[model samples]
Target chain A: MELHDKIRILADAAKYDVSCSSSGSNRENKNGGIGNASFYGICHSWSDDGRCISLLKILFTNVCIYDCSYCVNRCSNDIERALFTPDELADLTINFYRRNYIEGLFLSSAVYKSPDYTMELLIRTVKKLREDYNFNGYIHLKAIPGADINLIRLAGLYADRMSVNIELPSEKSLKLLAPQKTKESIIKPMSFIHSKLLEKSESKKLMRHTDKFVPAGQTTQLIIGATPESDRTILKLSENLYKYYDLKRVYYSAYIPVFNGNNLLGVSSPPLLREHRLYQADWLLRYYNFKADELLTEEELNFDVLLDPKINWAMKNLNLFPVEVNTADYNMLLRVPGIGLRTAKRIVKARKAANLNYDSLKKLGVVLKRAKYFITCNGKYYGGCEIETNKIKNKLLPKSNVLEGQLSIFDSIYKTESNLPILV
Target chain B: MVNYIFDGTFDGLMTVIYVSYYNRQIPNDILSENSYQKNFLGDDIYISTDINKSDKVQNAITTKISKEALKNIYYVYLSELESSYMLIYKYVRLGFKIGRKINYFLQNDIVNDVIKLSQRINHEAYKMIELIRFKEIKKGLFYAKIHPDYNVLPLIVPHFAERFQDQYFVIHDVKRNLSAVYDKKSWIITDIPPEITLITKEEEDFENLWKIYYKSISIEERKNLRLQRQHMPKKYWDMLTEKQ
Candidate 1:
């Protein structure tokens, strides 16, 4: 096949694996290297789907031996197939990096011949990019499940970040939809990378110069709504991943029904809003110090479609409302729906100088539309209405069908602030 | 009422702050020569750019206040907003009085305005870092053209210079008619002709491939042009290779 045709096929096949971040790596350029990784990732462009195009995200090949029912690249599906030569992929990455078109390569592939063989191909491509081309840009490699431990270790040395897609949320879903993949196969590699990263850090502390092994750490993706896994279950799993495996991020991809199979959910559209809620919940878990159980309970299996996860949590715990912005701790300020990390920090800093009021909070970038309901400045409430749970819920709900429109990937204010470098 | 006019340089602005400080006279407004309007009521004082005075002011800011404050002041200057000069003046004066605590005085209108303007400039600079796309102009020379709302050429050049160390590239800010030229080792901001076209044959091939890659990567099932426009604003679409 032609090169353009190969790129089209492979890139289209890879778009389903939605781990597009290029941040958290600070790989410096070597003396004669062609590129370097930014500690805070740079987005080269935004795709028509509203996702940030940070890396040259493409599969090394679209040929798969596994027959995952939900995947577009299932062996049963009769789609175009293409494989890139190691040199071809490396040259493309270097050229694209030179033009400032991408941060680096995000090389993922289907299980072509075998897990180990496919893993070897990925290693060779990154090896050529790093050794031959002397490229020091950020690389995110997909660690093929059930690949050799040694091979995975070697790949981690070159990749800034590596991931093994959990594929589905539940073990039953994996068995039903992707019979070829097992829970053990995915978790084993993830655990191995986690251990190796721990060892790398330990060595770096003792020795001044230790070979970087996944310097940006590992991340994983879970396919949401494909199985009967509730938002609570998904978030709980993410919490465990962050705790146990020390994963940098757990990406939730809304299932886009590509193949008509009885095993998959027959959804008309991707569960984007649910995925969005999961991200918000994830942010709260990571930055806002909220636990998964705190965000959702066993009674409420799913997030409220009308409100954000934070707002929903706030409404449930309305007894905690009207936290004094001037006297509230930083953590309390963060719980307010519209008070983001930046704004919360700003409030904490600004309040030290003077007692804050509603007007000052607005100038400090606090989204007063929502925060007014939860905060009191100088012992005065500005929510206009009494803090009744149902009334507040009715008031806070979207006035229009705003959720019908496709949501921007970075719609969450916290997500954008997290992307910015932490202010000094 | 008196208006202070400077030569529109960062140093000149600093000098205006210095002159106002020593004289202990608050100007009704501070304006760059380009932005200055003749008002019958206010007397105009042209403050010439002085290196010594500006350096003294800069040193004082760095020493008395935090380095973070100086950085904010510089970013606010780069914004070139009409009120940026007065905002900086008020901010610096407050910084001198409160030391490093000026940043925490977010309730103060002058401090708040200065911080917001600086953040705006920094945001644009970071956006430029993301949106810059270079095309191979010559055999080994790459060129990119941008028209950012703020003067972010200086802020973004260091990033490209560090990332693409071995490659020669020029990022031209078309609105300002300035280019940041990097030649393997170092980079410098220089003036460039407004209408310089340097597209090579190979550059066209790569551009086509990139456009194809961009198109293929977007899932047709999740097409969201509204969200796309929100993230990558329509104003920047003209210079983007894929959009073109």
Candidate 2:
């Protein structure tokens, strides 16, 4: 088959992975090397679904042995199959990088023939790209489950990032969907990469120049809505993975049903809004110093689709609101729904010079429409209405999902003369 | 109210700040020489581009504030906003008064405005570095065109130069009629005359392949054109290979 045909089939097979971020490590071009990695990864293009495309994400082959129900390339599924030789893959990556088509390569594959064989082909392809081609660009390689530990470690040295996807969140789902694969087969490689990364960092302190092992660190993806796992369960697992493994990121790929025949899958895919809410809650867990238990409960299986997780949390904890912004600590300021990390830092710095009023807070990039109810400036409450839950909810909810131009209760009462664009 | 007119250059902007501080009066407005507004009421001063005076002001910023702040001020000048000159003038005056402590005053409108302008410029430059698509026009020569919201051609070339060190490429900012030409050894920014067309036979083939791959990778079940446009705005649509 032609190379273009292979790219279409292989790229189509690989699109479901959805972990195309090429960031978190900085590698300069060597004297003879052709490319480098920036700390802030660049999005080369946006795919139609709005996800950033940072790498040439493709699978080595779409042919598979295991019959995972959620997978597009399962053995039972009939899809066009193609494979790229190590040389063709390496050359395609270099050619694309030269034309500035991608930051690097995201190489994944189904278990073609066997796990070990598929992993061997992947290793050969990446090793050729790095050593033979003198390619110094970012390479995110997948660690095939049940592959040799030595092979995983060796691939880590050449790749900038590595991931062993826990495709299903729980062991029960792994058993139900993919009987051939066990949870241990997936997690063993993850622990191996985690230990190797730890060793590399420790050795770097002692020795001036130690070989880099997955310099951008590791990440994994979990398929949401495929199985009947609650949001609380998913987030709890993610928090543990972050705390224990020191993983860089845990991506949540919303399940898109490919095979219609299976009774095990849903008739229609889950709402994208659910996926978006999970991302917001995940951000709070990662950056805003919120714990999993704080944000979730057994009664509330999932986040409210209408309200964001931060606002939901704030509304639940109203006593925390009406906190004086002039005297609030950085943590307290961060908890306000509208103040981001940048705005909180700005408020901290600006408040030292002058006591910030509502106008000053807006100038500092705070979303005053949401923040005014929660905060007080200089012992004065600018929020007109008494603190009430349903009233605040009515004020914050979009007039309709179609258009976000809903006038809040405050907007109806007072209108500003200046027509400066609101950042929010 | 005093009005200061300056050449559209960073050095000229710095010279205006130096002259304003030396004269000991806050100008009501600073206008670029190219601006259309003619005001007969205020005293209008045409400030010549003085390198020595500009250098003195630049040095004071480095000593009083920081090198990073000076670099940001330069980026703000690249914004080409009409009010940027006066805003920057007011900002530097405050910087000199507060010395190094001026960095902490985020509440001040002048300080915050300068920071916001630089952020806007930097964001556009970063987006251009990602969205730029180079087509192979000759054996070893590649070319791409863009129309970024900010004048970010000066900022993007260094990144592309370092990334594609052994090749020659030209990145044209079509809106500004400016192009950064990069040879294997070095790069130089130059003006491109009208009626220049850059195309190649093989370029179409590559573009078709890229568009195919772009389409194939997107999940049909999760198509969100609005979200796509939010990240890759409509203004940059024409220059993109896939979009074209």
Candidate 3:
């Protein structure tokens, strides 16, 4: 097949992987190559489905001997199968790159013959992009689960970021859903790569010289609403991975029901709303200072279908809030139902200038309908219809799936930091 | 009995603040050429375009507010705001009176709005790295250009410097002829007359390659044009390496 034909087929197959942030790397362009990875931040792109497409997300090949039940490209599926040689992919990347189509390449694969064969093809493609083409753009290589550690490490040097997906949360789930893969194959490489990143970080600390080692750090993905894994199990596992491996991100792909036959997941798609709630909860865990135990339990397999995670937490722990804004610490402010990072900082900064009243707080970006019930504005109550809980329920809309306005070309061209546009 | 007028520069803004501190309750307005038309006849209107007065006002801010607040004040002034934006100037000045013990103003919508403006400028400049696609010119210099909303041409420099450490490159904020040039080791912001800069045949060569790549990578099944444009807008195509 022509190279263009291969890219069309392979990019479609590869789009599902979803980890394309070219962030956290600080590599610069060398003698003849173009592009570099800056450490401060990287550009991120989101598909209409809201998945980030910051890199040239593609697969080397979709041909698989090992059929993971959740995978769309599994062997039994009649979807087009394609593969790109190392040289062809590099050509396409450089071509797209010079055109300004994508930031870099995000190459993943199904087991093309075997783990080793697939791993070698991936490594060769990256090596060619770096060596033959001298292309220095961001390359996120997906580490095949059963690929040799040696192959993984070599590919690691050429790529800015690498990931080995621990697709199922547990070994039991892996056996039940993706029989061809095992926990050891996944964790062993994850552990190896995680340690190397740690080793590089420690060396840089001692040496005070910047050397590269997976500078974008490592990230992994988990398919939610697949098999029997509960929200409690998923988040607990996510927390452990972050704490243990020092992972940069743990992406939760809401299971899209596109598979059939003995494939594990049930129904058409994972509740996207539930997945969205989990992301908000995940944000709380990573940045907002919430813990796993604070949000979920074994019985609750998913977040409340009606209310968001934070709102549910606030109503359940009603005794904690009505906290004064003037005195509440950053943690307490972050815990407020309607408050986000920008708003929390605003509350902290503005409190320095004047006493916060209900009006002032409203101006600061707190969602008063929800936050008002839980907070006191200068020791005065505002929320709740009659100081009776259920009466206030009518006021706060539960889980409003605010369909975001379509991101216009102009908006993306000049998008500001808040992830919102001034014109919009 | 006087209203002070300034040239709309940050320094000009500070001069007004300096005079206001000395002469309380002065019915004054800060006006830029972009907004100001006629001057009032009766009141003593002092055009304090003097750099020294601007200095005095700025020094007072540093003393009254933290150095951080002074920076905020300067940035808000950079908003290139209309004359009615005086409310922000007053709000920011009030911010100093409250000091570090008073973070409540961070939540003040006016203060937040200005901060967001500075942040947007910074963010747009930074994003030009990933989003500002470049073409290899015939002269062999890798060149990319952008027309971002804020003054991001300055903001995107250190990034291109650290990453493309040993390459010859130019990232021009085409809106302003200011371009960032990296010559192997360091970078310099240079003024270029973009209207006159000749784009050569190599751009055509690279342009065709980029289009082929752009078309090849897109999958029709997930071809969400709205989403594609959401991340890479069409207006940018006028300057992109691959828009055709």
Of the candidates shown, which would achieve the greatest lDDT relative to the real structure?
1
Q: Write the per-residue lDDT of candidate 3 for residues A1-424, one digit (tens) a residue.
A: 7665666677667755656667677676778457665454344444434234457778888889977778878788878777777877787777665544567888898898889889999888888888787777788889999888998888788878889898877888889878988888989989999999888878887897755667787889887777677888889999999999988888876666656666454465345656556666777788778888889866566776566678767766777867888789988988987777767887887776678888877777776767787788788878745544465555665434222211122233322111221111
Candidate 1: docking tier: medium
Higher-scoring candidate on lDDT, 1 or 2? 1
DockQ, cand. 2: 0.54
True-structure lDDT of candidate 1: 0.84
lDDT of 1 at A123: 98
- Per-model TM-score of chain B: 0.95, 0.93, 0.71
- Per-residue CA lDDT of model 2 for B1-244, tens digit only, reads 7888988888898899888889987888888899747778778998999999999999999999888789878998899988887777777878878878776788787888888889889879977888888888777788888898889999999998888887788998888998899877788888964234567776677777778788888877777676577667888878788887
Between candidates 1 and 3, the DockQ winner: 1
By DockQ, who's the top model here?
1
Q: Chain B in candidate 2 has what TM-score?
A: 0.93
lDDT of 3 by residue, B25-86 (tens): 54556566545666556464545567998777667666766666666555555445563347
What lDDT would candidate 2 get against the real structure?
Answer: 0.81
| Candidate 1 colliding pairs | none
Calculate DockQ per candidate and list them.
Answer: 0.64, 0.54, 0.30
Candidate 1: tens digits of C-alpha lDDT, residues A267-318: 7667776777787788889888999999899899998766778888998899
* Candidate with more favorable, higher lDDT: 1 or 3: 1
By DockQ thresholds, what CAPRI class is model 3? acceptable
